[model samples]
Target: MNKETVEVIDRELLTDRDYVSPGLEIIKPDKCFPNMIVEDTSASDWPYLRREIPHNWYVDQRNNYVGFLSRDEANIVYNTALKFRGKRALEIGCWYGWSACHIALAGVELDVIDPLLAKEDIYESVTNSLQCAGVMDLVNLVIGYSPQKVEELAQQLQRKWSFFFIDGSHDAPSPLNDAIICEQLAQTDALILFHDLNSPDVAQGLDYLKQKGWNTMIYQTMQIMGVAWRGNIEPVQHQPDPKVNWNLPEHLPNYSVSNLSADLVKEFLEIVTAIRPYTLLGEARLFSLYSLAKKVCIEDIPGNFVECGSYKGGAAALLAFVIKRYSLRPRLLYACDTFAGMPDPSEVDIYNGIPANLTGFGVGALKAPIAENIKSICKLLNVEDIVVPVKGLFAETLPQYKSEIGNIALLHADGDWYESTMDIFNTLYDSVVPNGLIQVDDYGYWDGCKKALHDFERLRGEQFNLHRIDYTAVWFKKGNFLPN
Candidate 1:
């Protein structure tokens, strides 16, 4: 029972490299609880309580327990270990040894490296949990940080690992750094799993593995998990929960304002300066409108530009300016609105259990200035010829001018109320040509507006892959013209 001599021998056996003073502490469980039987009830408590248990396991009470891995995520770890049973495994960042216990239970020889294990409390908890699970003897706990510690293990072991579970630092270079080092030490056909792919920075590590010729796939666990391997091994497939909103996982093409030409930037600045006093739209939203206008013209989308709720004629003015400067052929800008104020919000315009009228919206709430003022602004911009102001309710004017409006290349639906917003889509959504853009200005600010868009989606039997323009505005193309 010589403690220091046993530590030196364990270090030498686990890692052949020279042990630096105050270096990694290798703890080998002595099988003190040899007769202990981890009851099935143990799975119904602490870190495993809230996790989804296997159907065969009986539980007395199901309570909530918060931990790193969800039930599905833990299954992934256990299944991966089973695939490589009897092989050497390495895990970085083992919090309370939940994932470590899962790995050990699969008959895999595991080495878990984590900096927090140096603390006495964390060490006791991890060992106690592992011992309770009847797998403490299968895991060699290493106390140190990753990348550097991983490098030392690589040098000392001088052997490739069959499986790697990297749940290390989620910061940018930290995850990426661990992936780089792990890939070097991994066998040619090894499987490498990474947790927390929901973090953009952590996802970069998985991205690197793909770049290096590993077959990669992502599982939509609570925090998201990704696996990369080089061989024919197919990891178990876990479908994402239908209840969770897995925000767009794949890349989509978007219009970047930074790519705008210097001349276009200057033109946009001039338009914003001219219309700043007439509209309530922020610079980001106005710029989006300006960009979309240019896009339709450049692509020859073959229709007019229309604004449904032209509050004070600012956004309409910007669209008119874009057409005047960029369009190769003649195209008109239709400013459709009441020109008096917003119409009365109906019962359907309820938001968060409150009527829209109670939340600063009612008849005459967003009234525009006198018609003469809109006309004066149009004249000042020299866009009066193309900017046609159709003053009336969208319900009335849109149908009245259906033949005149014809096919629309772009639609800016700014109507704040649910009814008014739906009116714009109901009357004109079909008129928008394929690949055209429909920008909703209040989709995020007004819940009613959001509901209207969702209702429209249900009516169309398809969802619009909306792209955010700002905090309150979003836009989508008329059809699926680009990959999501």
Candidate 2:
């Protein structure tokens, strides 16, 4: 019998149609085949084959020869396709559904196709994992490869996938068929990802795809394979082309100095400085904070610096300089700004009275292109490292600072209004490592900033000390406060 007919008959004989019995047990490999070779062609980096799959699953090959996925790789793929979640997704060669689980984690309803799942036990394991991951309800597991079955599934679901992943058979013929299925079923803007292009079986398929005019990039270093729609197509390119200018695909994580060299840091800082131009764009208070941060950055501060109100990133440019100078380990200067000016004044009272500056002060309108600016700075510094530019209001965007919050040695607040200052101070204060300095721009220049600082002092009492050094106001954490 053919593979499809044999799978169906085998499944039917094991149990009643309604009471689907488990499929045949697979003999798990003693060592994952993907990791046998460390060459560029090896699945050495197929995060799933290396880190994420558990030993229990590996030992019980009867659960299907499905592999696991690393948390890092899972997050990367989820983030990369974040904009398309909640829409339809298709995963071919789903193994035990690890990648499908991740897609569902991003809030997408996914169709996971696998012939191995025809085995009752393997199917049960996959379904159990999906339910455990809170995605069983969103996932529709398909057993056979009938194009008609796939079409019917798509029609019954009344949805089309915006994202498609081919992870099934790496054999040339299987991947080629899977790609054809994805092309036929995907919506116009659908982005397709193919795994194991480095595999011998899929090499020809990848080359065929390139000839077909698909835009492809090999994440060889990470050993994750992916492909996307060429140029721009329908439903896929629908949303305002996401902020590709910054190129911080969630798939890519931020880099710290510990992993970078001095030359790299200096080169990147120069690029940031070019775009943010501390001297050219920032206000007097920001200028001073920039100067001070640069000085301390040159010293032994063991962490990253933050600019909560980096309108155009002038202060960030200064921090970038310091990041390069020290070659500090594990610290990256994070420049946060609402590329589009500020949030509406209606949401916060800070901008209620001040006249709008070069850019509308209280509106969520962009004064300058944030991504382009940072890119320019990167180019000037000749640093390959990317400066993460988060776009959103302080309240909405600060939450992402969680990773570096506890290690922040310096914080420059340039919101210039009471609500803005209060938000950052209250929310991020506890996260500041001991002895860190909180610098406030416009503390003396604007009524709103001063009022907020006073309120903070009243609340904290002796917890911290506030000092005025020229145009800027600085807060030194008590007890741990040390001098440079």
In terms of lDDT, the best-performing candidate is 1
Report the lDDT tens digits of candidate 1 across residue range 136-244: 7778899999899988987887867889999987777899998999999988668899887766677788888888988887765545678888753445434444334
Each model's lDDT: 0.71, 0.52
Q: Quick one: best TM-score, which candidate?
A: 1
What lDDT does model 1 reach? 0.71
> Which whole-number lDDT from 0 to 100 does residue 194 have in model 2?
62
Candidate 1 clashes between residue pairs 3 or more apart in a chain or in different chains: none
For candidate 1, which ten residues in a row score worst on lDDT?
16-25
**Per-residue CA lDDT of candidate 2, range 1-484, in tens?**
0111111121123212111101111111112222211122132333334232121212233322433433323333453344354567787766656566666655567787778889886687777766655557878898977445567777887657778777777655776666766677767666776665445455445555655666654432122455556423211111111111212223323211012233433443344335434333222233345445555555656556777776655556656655665644656666776676665442223322444342244456446576666555645664326356767677877876665445777787777667778877787766666666677766644566777777876787643444433223443442442222
> For each candidate, how many residue pairs have backbone atoms clashing (under 3 Å)?
0, 21
Indicate the TM-score of model 1: 0.51
